[model samples]
Target: MEKTASVSGAQTIHKAISLLKFIARFSGEGARLIDLVRGMEIGQPTAHRLLQALVAEGLVKQDTSHRYHLGSLVFELSLTSGHHFNLADICTPVLKKLADETGDTSFLFLRSGDDAICLAREQGPYHIQTPVVPVGSRQPLGVSAGGLAILSALSEQEAAAVLKAITPRLVMFGNLTTDRVWEYYLKSNAVGYAAISNRAAPGVKGVGVPIIGEIGTPIAAVTLATTISRMTEERIQEIIPALNEAAEQIDVLLRQF
Candidate 1:
């Protein structure tokens, strides 16, 4: 009886996790029950029960329109400071300094659900800068150096889930596959940062470091973007320290609030 109960509980947890991921996929507009139930193997009754349990745990919330959204507790667990964070504003000074020091355009990217959003950019003195990703653009969380850095900072399981969620969007990048992104994540994890080239734009190169927020969760990334000419293997090695320092500085500043 005990073993049977344990297996059943594990299945329940798995279903709940699936439900959360589903809601996150459609999080922008929120998710309705029928929307969630459609095409999923889990029946409506089971999903509703799981959602209620998640809601009771503050992991999910329902609105007047009966739409489900990830709850404040989710942010609290990741950010710990409620909903008032201005990650770009907080990281601008570091971005400017990084750009000035490296002569490569610096970008601040915030993790938004399964996507990475470019919140701000600081152009360097380099006349041939490559700001391929403009501010306010969004991409899957394992696409560029910025997103890969954020993915590298997450726990193995969390990173895998994110990779699974973003696999469909990865195809738009020509050569990006879930396996390729996972390889990038593994490399970044081993090397303490992320670097990518010629993917976001031809001849573009970038190095990124993840910013550790409250509770040690990676909430953003600081990426130094440049042309391949300026970001050679030697320069990438040289620029990593500056990027790490800037990420640390941003992390420290973010904790103050």
Candidate 2:
């Protein structure tokens, strides 16, 4: 029999997160009940119970076909928590300025479970804007500079949980292991910024900074990307100050509502 990993003293939460992740993998079309149960290695009754709870909470929804998909609440929550909406709108101006001034592509990314999804993008004036990570695309945290910045800004326990959750997904990116992500986090934290190579695009590099919440937790990240030939070490250092400024401005704007 295959050994299944369980979180000590938090089995229910673990199972729930696992279920959600499993559903997300197939939720593009819709996830079937038997598939979810088998994929999560949980019994039918337990899966049903969890699914019901998630539906009630508006995190997941069951359609007329008896298949599940992520709910609208997820998108709403991404914008605000008990406040106004327009997260993308709030940050777009800052990103636009960054792109125009730096002559590189700028992106805004938000964390959703163990993955980072690009929320917005601003193309630079440069003729060759690096098509690193496209808007709406999601990838495991630490795969891109913006994601790495968010991961690095997380508290130790939070960061550990995210890393543990995304471990299996990292293999798709060549040589991007858990240890490698941890190393990236350390480096980003030390420099007060994230400068990562191959930001989901080979031969590309990106620099980013986290937008810290009032409690000092990272809520999102802003990044600028270009080809390796354009993102030299000195350039990375030079861009850090501007990136940090933009992140700070966005954080302040977020607190208004």
Candidate 3:
């Protein structure tokens, strides 16, 4: 009887996890109790009990209509897990110094869900500028050089999912096919840096180097954006070494954090 009871408890935990995954995948349209019960193929009473447990743990919340949605617990867990580091605190001063030295805009970005969130930025002395991706604004993971750098850091399965999520928006970029994206990822991995010219924005070009973590994963990216006219082959060659050196310094700082 004891062994049977333990098995049942494990099964119950698995069911609850499945329910949470279902709710998270469709967070925009919250799932009702009936919807969850039906989707998870569990009895109403079991579903209700599991949901109550999840709600008590702050992982799920009920709306006025009694539909279930993901709660703040997931966000809290993500922060605690160190998947989302506080880049602004570590990168702000570095970015300011880079901008001052390079006379080109510097940006720090990290992967957040299906978007790359700008965490810090510094403007350059040059009046010519690309549109600033504001701090905390989300950019599609498929288009921006910063986004591609982050995507390239993800494991294959995770990167594929991110690409699928951002596919619809790829239309804005003339011919960005999935094969091209995968090719870019492979190239970026090999070269240790990513670059795009006239793709993210017209007349704007950028290069990015990944800030690798202790475990060799890409934790964030440091990018430099400038007018295409200023990004001549010779100029790109000159900046690549500086960008690489700065990326190493930032990576060291991040690991300390």
Candidate 4:
């Protein structure tokens, strides 16, 4: 009986660490308890207990919505470990070069389940500009170019699941029917890239290409976003080659890690 209890205690500690790691990955915006439970596939009581322990350790905190965010302990540990890899590390230089070369905002994004999470962004020199997609902002996979690029790389089943998850929110954007969304993904898959114009955020036009890993699976995406007025078909053609080259570079870098 005592041995079983000891084993259970150790398992609890491990689960607490897993929960902390999950929260750390999303850091600033945090996560809702229900989402965590569903994503982690853990029982509610177990998840709650682990989260409470993490809170006591200052590893997580509950916000107004009762969502959990990383606490000061994570910040302190980041200072010592230097382990946090921000999107800026991999993308700032690439975005700067793209912006300088194309005079358009450059962005980097990654698939986070049903959403595309913006990891990095750099603004262009132009006066008329697209609004910045803040780091950690999440967009549904069928709408934004960055999201579609990631979706295009997913397996059919995975892509379908993501689309189903975000179906309710689709109506708010471009009158996108499910059939149209599926067709878009198919076309994007065929072309190996995706583009969108003023779908969610008005006046912005975006083109995105996936960054594939060593195993030929997508790990991230690179996007070029510009004001609608500046995004002619000729301009998109000019940017595609550069975006593809940049995606390759990022893929190589990600493989190193």
Candidate 5:
């Protein structure tokens, strides 16, 4: 009976975590309970029970609109886990400096498995904003400038494997087929940064440089996003220096820890 109970507990924990990830994909817009049940392919009653348990643990919260969103506990745990060598803290200053220097939104994305997670963001002085991907959101590598930069830094064999794994998720991004991803990879390798114009978002362009570690491994990328009108050839040339400088600074800092 005790062994059976332990197995059941493990299964419940797995289900709860899966549910949390599904809810996190929605980010600011909490997911509806019905949608959660359907997405998880679980009965309404079982989903409700699992959710209630999560709510009790403060890992999930139901909004007034009956939608569930990730709770404060999730953020708190993330903070605690990375407190020793925090990527956000290390990249925040670099992001701010980039935004100030270029007057374009700056972002830091860290490679997490085959996905890239937005670890920090700094808004520029421009009145118009490009809300392509929010902080804390996860996007498949090669789908965004930052991700593509990191992807390009990988070895040929490693990059090919990652692209194959994430191909199914690339359909949502315009012109992000496997061949197109390789094109971006080659461009990034040639220019020392990844440049994408009107790819992730129309009228928005970006340039990204990989943050190389002490051992010459890329662990993250620094990117600048701006309006297409502002991304002229001259402007892109100017931004590359700033992006590369910032990435170098971040790399140095990362090596310290």
Candidate 6:
């Protein structure tokens, strides 16, 4: 009986942790109970019990609208663990300047496992803005300009491993196979930047440069997003220098860690 009880406790802990991570993926957007049930493939009663236990521990919270989100405990632990530093604080000013200069949206993306998560975004002084990945959104590595930049900055072997992992998720994003991602990486390496036209969204284009960190590893990338009509070859040439310069500045700032 004792051994059986211990096994059950361990399973419950695993389920709760998985649920917490799923909620974190949406950032603060929260997840409905039905969505969680379907996503975790657990019965509604089991999910509810696990969520209640997590909420009691302050690791998760349920809002008035009955949606679940990561609680303050998760953020407090992240700070203490030093897993994610003040990334937004460090990159927002640089992104703002880049956006102002280019008159387009600028984004900062950090590598999180096999995915790139948007950390910050700055909108420029343009009326016809291009819709882009929102803050806290995650994209498979090599799918977006920032993600492709990070992938290209990796060593050949490491990049191949990442491609293998994310290939299964590419179909959901349309036309983004491993072969296409490899092609993008090659183009990004040739120009010292990643440029994608109409990849993430229709009529929306982006260019990005990787921010290399300790021992020449890519910790993140900065990308500029604009409309397809504004992303001509001449414009890409003109903005490459600015993008490169911003990436360098951000790299220097992050190394101060």
Model 5 agreement with the true structure over 5-103: per-residue lDDT tens digits: 999999998998999999988876778988998899999998999999898775787766788887645644554485623767777888898898888
Candidate 2 structure, TM-score to reference: 0.67
> Lowest-lDDT window of 10 residues in candidate 4?
75-84
- Number of the top-ranking candidate, with TM-score as the measure: 1
TM-score of every candidate: 0.68, 0.67, 0.63, 0.66, 0.66, 0.67
Q: List clash counts for every candidate, in order.
A: 0, 0, 0, 0, 0, 0
Residue-by-residue lDDT tens digits, candidate 6, 201-235: 66788889998754345668999999888888899
Candidate-wise lDDT, in order: 0.81, 0.80, 0.75, 0.76, 0.81, 0.81
Error of 6 at 206 (Å): 0.6
In model 2, which regions exceed 4 Å deviation? 1-85
For candidate 3, the per-residue lDDT at 109 reads 75
Candidate 4 lDDT for residue 37 = 91
Instruction: Provide the lowest-lDDT 10-residue window in model 1.
Output: 76-85
Task: Count backbone overlaps in model 5.
Answer: 0
lDDT of 4 by residue, 1-257 (tens): 99999999998888887887787666456688887898888999989988888877756767666778765455335433653255358657877788778778888887655677787888878776675577768888878889889889877876797788899888878777777889989999998888877674777888899876432345578998887778887887888999998888776665554
Question: What C-alpha lDDT, on a 0 to 100 scale, does residue 154 get in candidate 3?
Answer: 68
Per-residue lDDT, model 5, residue 227, is 89
Q: Which pairs of residues have clashing backbones in candidate 4?
A: none
Native-referenced Cα lDDT, model 6: 0.81
Model 6 lowest lDDT segment of ten: 71-80
Instruction: Please provide the root mean square deviation of candidate 6 (C-alpha atoms, Å).
Output: 13.4
